[model samples]
Target: MAIALTTLVAEAQRYLNADSISDYCPNGLQVEGRPNVQRLVTGVTASQALIDAAIEAEADVILVHHGYFWKGEDPCVTGMKQRRLKALLANDISVLAYHLPLDVHPDVGNNVQLAAQLGITVEGPLNPDNPRTVGLVGSLDEPQSARDFARRVHQVLGREPLLVEGQQMIRRIGWCTGGGQGYIDEAVAAGVDLYLTGEASEQTFHSAQENGISFIAAGHHATERYGVQALGEYLAKRFAIEHIFIDCANPI
Candidate 1:
């Protein structure tokens, strides 16, 4: 069954509550396409590979967690940007994106999905004072050594995580998906035994070591894979539309 493109976008916005979040890019309908959508493609990022896959699948809409037009980025539609837009326009496929909203959604959010993958029993937000913190603080159902936890992360995310060992056992921990190393400060403030995020910085290592909190830099694409898939499944169920999650591999 095909649903109007605008209707689909509105439904996504409602489900994600995209309007409430302060995001770097537009939250919905980044590129308009055909009036109706049947097959939908969901992915971590709207890269050329994903777009090509969408075209191959004959998808009318591409839903993603990372889209273009980021804040402070050069807005000129040239080179790579021109190519991506050209393909979308040429094929009449809409690209819809939600960044923070997708990360923070309690049900299908990136952090919560990662929590399930890592076997975490979430206690609350990583930022205690903020009710809507993007990162989460939680506990393992059973505590394990930092090394073992890294193994677990590898098992779940299909990528070996970079481990900065801290406590012998990790019970309570903090995590955010996709280049969220900056939130290590918040994790430290929350007094968790460890912090896990994608893509660690040089200073993150120093801070984690000094503060006695273990750190894990799981692959950015790996940790962020779930939210888009979860949201895609939900949309598929909700609208009776076909949704396929295209995993375009990214190492950082």
Candidate 2:
């Protein structure tokens, strides 16, 4: 029912191929805790709410997609950072996080998981030339109007995405899970009928409009919910330990 914290971390690092992928933050074991883990908590982000929820749940380890110590962030552990680290240290709950590794994993990656949810049959990477590209190109089972595809996105993600309708029906589609509107140009180059991502920038509209490709900006949190859950389930099954996914909802 329980596994060593080191063992769990090693398994996760191996399973996700964490070390091979480059990321903004460290890939695994952001916070050290007890030697053994019986209950594992997983979430999209390691926010204060999630930490509190994990403490209440009596979790021994917290695995997440987003964790602390990002590049360019202030090195000083003050304010919100201090509080988050304090709670984790006090409770002896380990934190393991994966950013790009979770995004690009072929089996449990965010992009692949989103495609499965939206009924998109993945054809290939959004950018074949770039090994680091996290977006993907796929196709709907049938060609649907931009509005119809947007409706499907809303239904699946439980949030109404911002839609910029294009002139054509949505068949060949491209998407990246979080803050990937920057990849719209790559999607356009791939010849997708529509492009979807979590957050859109101002220039994204111009790119979509000029290129005649529909665009959808689903909430970043909503779009990325699945990968961590999938990874949690996989870990629980693999280690025969308890795993709980806590969603501390973020609108953005």
Clashes of each: 0, 0
Error of 1 at 111 (Å): 0.3
Distance from true location, Cα of 79 in model 1, Å:
0.2
In candidate 2, which residue ranges exceed 4 Å CA deviation?
Answer: none
User: How accurate locally, in lDDT, is each candidate?
Assistant: 0.92, 0.93
Candidate 2 residue-pair clash tally: 0
| Clash pairs, model 2 backbone | none
**What's the TM-score of every candidate structure?**
0.98, 0.99
Instruction: For residues 1-252, write the lDDT of model 2, one tens digit per residue.
Output: 888998999999999988888789889999999999899999999999999999999999999988999999999989999999999999999999999999988888999999999999999999999877789999998999999999999998989999999999889999999999989999999999999999999999999999999999998999999999999999999989999999898989
Q: How far is 158's C-alpha from truth in model 2 (Å)?
A: 0.7
